[model samples]
Target: MGTTDVVLTDTSPYGSRMVTVEYEGASSVAYLRGAGGGIHGAVWLANHGQAPSSVDLDRLGRGQAPVMPRAHTRIPEGTPPFTSAELEVLWFEEGDGAALYRNGDLLAVIPGWADLERGMPGYARDAVGESPFAWSLEEALEGLAPRIAKARSYWEWRHGDGAWRSFQQFAMSHLDTRVGPPGRYWDIGGETLPTVGITERPLDEYTVLSTVGMSCQRMPTVEQYIDRPDAYARVELAVATRHEPAEAAQLFLWLARYPWHSITWLGHGHTARWYGDAAGFPLGRSYAGVLMLDTVPGLPDMSGFAFGGDEVRWLWLIPLTDHELQIAAERGHDSLGLSLPGRIP
Candidate 1:
């Protein structure tokens, strides 16, 4: 059966939301409530958090763009009303995009407005376009609701790890195992992986955390290369000085092409087998394959190594001496497939 996603209220200011969602297969924040949209600001947080929107009214008043600097986790104890003239939204439609007023006014929607359009979904709040932290640990629980809502099965619900977990706890205090997906993988390692169990997810939810790439799916701020991430455009513009973005983007693309190669399973079957093969091959054989295990104990076998494709090919074609295979076995698996480069849909 397919995994189920369950949705429930998650309310809390200082903790993770404990949403009861099902089908939390992986522990990446990619499964977290709004880790994709909230941390990344793709879907917008105005509709998620207590406050109506994330627009900086002050900036709007100044005639400057009201780019929100950061997402406010909580509604200030004493704040203005939900109604605000400065409220604006940005989103794409049919063949174009627009930055409309939150209520009904269409502010400005023009070509090349992906930045403003993204902010309409709430990604624009980072006035500066990127965050400096590896991750925005102080995320709002409410923003992640859509993620769990969409991912959980009819019988399950998912929760967040940091502030999200706390929110889930507030919603139902605790969860009913058979009723729906448990809120968080409490006490698990810092991962957002699935829980293991018939009535429960196999992996621990509590300990799981989101990575930059995974976080990128939800919020642009969560980056894999940058602990504190920046917007794609920002990084693209800053590539010369900080080439990490370009490099990371390349890695992301490479990963997309070889998804089965993800070391998410804690290094197991495919890992030992594949790496074993690669290691067995002649010294320098650039062989690659998917280590299908969730995560192998000896996963990430290519620690501190890059794909020396040309060199590996030359080494493999030359053939390994007996001592070489023996030495390779001692290291780890190294299964290589004839990686025919292709494009990802």
Candidate 2:
């Protein structure tokens, strides 16, 4: 798309002198300068529902008004910090489970099937008549401890044998090394925090065309995904030591809609384009947000080492359209009150 640039002059509380705003199709890039001629903050606007016009630029340059086209929850300052030590559980359509990661280390993954069987000993006998079940962090950890012990023993046996050593050897070695003493291993706390519930329904009508395991063909580029007709969305869930759950939700919404540039150190590479809307269902915990993109293409499977860990993990999800989500919410499938853009729930 061709770009257009406009310069406006205005004075403001911050002593702004001139602001140059450029519009390129659905995106806008702006640079603010102070009266003293020093460059201020640079802002890039995209997927914000409306493209900024020359008149909008003129108003912004003059500081006459704000150009927010949609209502957004302001991310408060001094938000809580997100550390890698907290456990995060992601429930996808393929399987329901909790992935336990502590300080960038993969502790264990307890599948929902296993959780159900263990949580309710008579689940098999009552499988036909059992009601839906809800899993909690405490239950996840309860199942996780034995799994961790089994993993540690397996790693110790395999590593000590020295017959199956590989580049991945160090990761397992660290697992054993990190377990300092018994009864103090794997930081399972006694309290339970607020848990965020996630519900996923299949989009059987739409199929995401992308690369999969060992395919030599290049994966679809982000631009290709953007050009596709199918509606898509992204939901990001994160946990950390310190940070307000709401603040993280707001940040996730902002990142999904805005074409913000960031550096991520995980998987094989870190270059990614985050474009969409700043509206999403907030997973009520520390640093967890879900972004749902509409009418966009599906994203290719990407992997990275989050929290500077050796375990490479693939990140992928299927985003539901507003209509689909609304239907689900109306059916009372999700109690979290998941809503679409411009929706107040």
- Give lDDT: candidate 2, residue 139: 37
Q: Cα deviation of 93 in candidate 1 (Å)? A: 25
lDDT at 179, model 1: 24
TM-score against truth, every candidate = 0.20, 0.18
Model 2's lDDT to the true fold? Answer: 0.27
lDDT of 2 by residue, 1-345 (tens): 243434223332112123333343333333344346554333332222342332355544653322322221122111222222342322111111223343454422433233223442111110122221222233345645554454445335433545223322332232233221111111111122111121111122321111111010011122223342111112122211122323333333333212211111111112222233324333222212222322112322222222111222332222344454445446632433434322211
As for model 1, its CA RMSD to the true structure in angstroms is: 20.7
Which digits, one per residue and each the tens of the lDDT, describe model 1 over residues 253-302? 22221211221111122222223445533122343322222222311111
Candidate 2 wrong stretches, greater than 4 Å: 1-148, 151-302, 306-321, 324-345
lDDT of each: 0.23, 0.27
Question: CA lDDT of 109 in candidate 1?
Answer: 21
The C-alpha stretches of model 1 lying farther than 4 A from their native spots are 1-39, 42-191, 195-286, 289-345
